[model samples]
Target: MRSDLCSLLGIEKPIFSAPMGGAAGPDLVASVCNAGAYGVIPLWGKPVDQVAAGIDQIRALTDRRFAVNLNLSFAYEDALEACIQAGVHGVSLFWGMEPSAIARAKAGGLVVMSSVGSVAEGQAAEAAGADIIIAQGWEAGGHVWGQVSTMALVPAMVDAVGVPVVAAGGIADGRGMAAAFMLGASGVWIGTRFLASREATIHPDYLTHVLGASEAQTEWYHDLYDVAWPNAPHRALSNSTARAWRDAGAAPPGQRPNEHEIIGTRPGGDPVVRYQSYTPLPGTTGDVEAMSLWAGQGVALVREVQGAAEIVDEIFDEAMTCLAGGPGKPGPN
Candidate 1:
């Protein structure tokens, strides 16, 4: 059941974990890679020292290939160079990147993948020499690049690009993956499902919200939380902060209530300021419920926490079953 994309990445599965900054830390990435699924860690806005250091940790954990990503919208050039030097198997470029930059990564012998919000963006990425193109939909959690659903965007990008297309957004289970394969996606990039896994370093409260909520509880719109990373539209679970902002008339950036308020702290005690675009991690306290509960529309399907490998195997079995024209179920194929 492997696709060319999996063969290109040398992974047994066609599932690529989303490079969720802050949430998808090195532990989760390494676990997924070791499990035979592609793992991606977001490197943008992180400390330069941590870029290679995180790769070191993953390398120590698993010898398998994995990827790191850069959100050009808030990237540090030096970090990009550092990743190239570290020799990660792949690098995902996002947020309207220049083709020359993708060329630079390719020159370093790094497999280049770019995320696109539109079919035109997919074409541009392919022209820019992206070896793989991730078609990110509006249903994806955290900061979204463009406004299109997976159902419509995947096939369009597949039609638009010559490279392999990876479908993202709203995909939470084997059913979604099978559907994506039918839509011409060479692979599927899953986020929220990984967020519910045991390897994720997010706050327990956040996990609780993900498990307890339904699909309708998740919402995507513009709000103040983007103050830390402005201009990028994101999708997340409806939490207290979202409710307050929504009730307060959904004010624009500058007019939002409690602007710059210090809401919580990082697990290591770093101050979590208002609108910081911070996803609650372990050891975090103070209004954890109010912090960004970023998740995909697939959050509804996320029922419980399991090891990363188990989640991968479960998804693999069900997706294979669906593709084989059988009823999707857990357990064995």
Candidate 2:
């Protein structure tokens, strides 16, 4: 049974991949779209030209529709305009809400999806003309917005908004998707599970950590990785940097242990310091483990890496089985 939200987004499956920065590259996004599930490409903080190029890259890979996600915490007016000009299917906004931005996107004929942490935020986004509301819980990877859990936020958002609600954070397998649907989510927004997709561009070490982590291994932080991005609350695997900070009294930014130490370098020769909001990609060199390794509590269920299309099919099948009164496995096949 295809959800109305799926039809609205022009996809067959009601699964929307999270717009994970760096990891959600064109290949992964295209793979998900080709699988009839929605894909979201993270384009926040990039220049207008790069944004256009990124869209073009995805277009070259798949003819199916997908969205470009923008972090409102950063300047995104130009990038949003670029997506509008490129005739993309939709735009997902997160981190903050701006009615003007939503109005402008809607005016440009884009389906606007906004991520919120609470019922009040969902109502505000619906009022601001958001066609879809993504209720992100504290267990979500990367930058988390709200303090509530998915179990508590999904139904509240559905009841609070007139638009469709997409449940995010801590969802991994078919059991999780079925649970989200039971909680009144029209669709599920997944991030950590997709990190294990073969098409994802994350570093091998990062993938290793995701495949091995448990539900209790991830910890929520308030600006722990705040070199380029600050004042953002996020969830990532508890690693050396996190342990060091906690061991040293969980000091605030600038005073944290080894605050100025360079942990690695990006493919483009940019230095990556400890506690910086940087995902380790293939070309990254130097202490990769010490860098920020983002993952949700769903990491416990992501036990192996599989092709994006295969991953989508497995989850969809299992979710359908679960919805049809069968016992769906809690972890990946």
Best by TM-score: 2
C-alpha local distance difference test of each model: 0.86, 0.92
lDDT of model 2, residue 258:
91
* Candidate 1 lDDT over residue span 267-314, tens digit each: 788888766688888899788888888988988899989988888888
* True-vs-predicted CA distance for residue 141, candidate 2, Å: 0.6
Per-residue lDDT of candidate 2, residues 150-224 (tens digit) = 999999888878889999999998899999999999999999999999999999999999999999999998899
Residue-level lDDT for 81 in candidate 2: 97
Q: Give the TM-score of candidate 1.
A: 0.96
Candidate 2 residues lying further than 4 Å off, grouped into runs, are 330-333
Clashing pairs for model 1 are: none
TM-score of candidate 2 against the unseen true structure: 0.98
- Model 1, residue 211: distance off in Å is 0.6
